[model samples]
Target: MEIFAIQGYVDLVVFVVLLAVKLFAFINSLLWSAESYEAAGKLTKPAWTIILGIGVLLQFIGILFILSIAFTIAAFVYLADVRPALAGLRRR
Candidate 1:
């Protein structure tokens, strides 16, 4: 059980760290794409820019939600596995 708890914590930490990296990548991709489109002069149209922005925002939100769900599951598993042992350890 102790070993499982340790593994769980490690998994949770890794998940969060990876999620952060992914989020950074997503934001950078969106910004770069938008800038590239603008540089090409196609992004001059307000409507088109708005449409692209909304689409990118939606995609970003979706990815964020997915990452949040993944981390939530990892956290729940870690807590469930380790709470008992942690409490016991505290008593000593």
Candidate 2:
């Protein structure tokens, strides 16, 4: 019983962290200009916005775990790859 309780807490932490990352990615996507995405050779701003938005929404609802994981991967891609490309353009 104690182990189950600990596992529940761990699961809750994971869920919260996933939601935070998705929310951050969605918000950051909104901050960049459409032109910045084009200049960086990434997807259009609207596309990213929609993708991240859906991810955040799905994560928040917490019903479909598989879909949530898929969207989480999308968030990671935006943060790890597309974000740096856009940030690079901003620095130059």
Candidate 3:
């Protein structure tokens, strides 16, 4: 298959996966906030830790999404620029 076509497909997949990540993050944030934890049991340290852990996980997940975006962009840039440069070198 052509390089452009393959890269386009990969970009589309990344976009869809990112969309799902956003939705899940929103839901999890709502579920892990103070109010949600308050509804779980007496407002204790452990309860707060659970809430804080959720926040940390959310941040980690956000980082993963950012990295995924970076990699996806890099993939396209490599295909558009680096690959062609390598191809030119190969033809010499």
Candidate 4:
């Protein structure tokens, strides 16, 4: 029983963290201009916004674990790749 309780807490933490990441990605996506995305040679702003938005919605719905993982990867991709590319353009 104690182990189960610990597992539940761990699961809750993971859920919250994933939600935060998705939200961050979605909000960050909204902050950048559409032209910036094109300049960065990435997907359009609307495309990323929609993708991150769906990830956030799915996090809330909490129905499909596989889909959640997939979107999490998407969020990370945006954060790790797209974000840096966009930021680099700002530096130029």
Clash number for every model? 0, 0, 0, 0
lDDT of each: 0.46, 0.95, 0.47, 0.95
For model 1, residues 1-92, the per-residue Cα lDDT tens digits are 89999999997786556555444433333443344434444323344334334434544455565645554444343234333333444366
lDDT of 4 by residue, 1-92 (tens): 89999999999999999999999999999999999999999999999999999999999999888988899999999999999999999899
1-92 per-residue lDDT for model 2 (tens digits) = 89999999999999899999999999999999999999999999999999999999999888788888899999999999999999999789
List model 3 lDDT by residue over 1-92, tens digit each: 69999999997786666445444433433444454334433343344344434434544455566555554443344335433443454365
The 10 consecutive residues of candidate 2 with the worst lDDT sum are 60-69
Candidate 3 local Cα displacement, residue 79, angstroms: 31
Looking at model 4, the pairs that clash are none
Which 10-residue window of candidate 3 scores lowest in summed lDDT?
A: 36-45
Model 3 misses residue 25 by how many Å? 0.7
3 or 4, which is superior by lDDT? 4
TM-score of 3: 0.35
lDDT of 4: 0.95
In candidate 4, clashing pairs total 0
For residue 58, model 1's alpha carbon misses the true position, in angstroms, by 15
Model 2 CA deviation exceeding 4 Å by range: none
TM-score of each: 0.37, 0.97, 0.35, 0.97
Better of 3 and 4 by TM-score: 4
Winner on lDDT (1 vs 3): 3
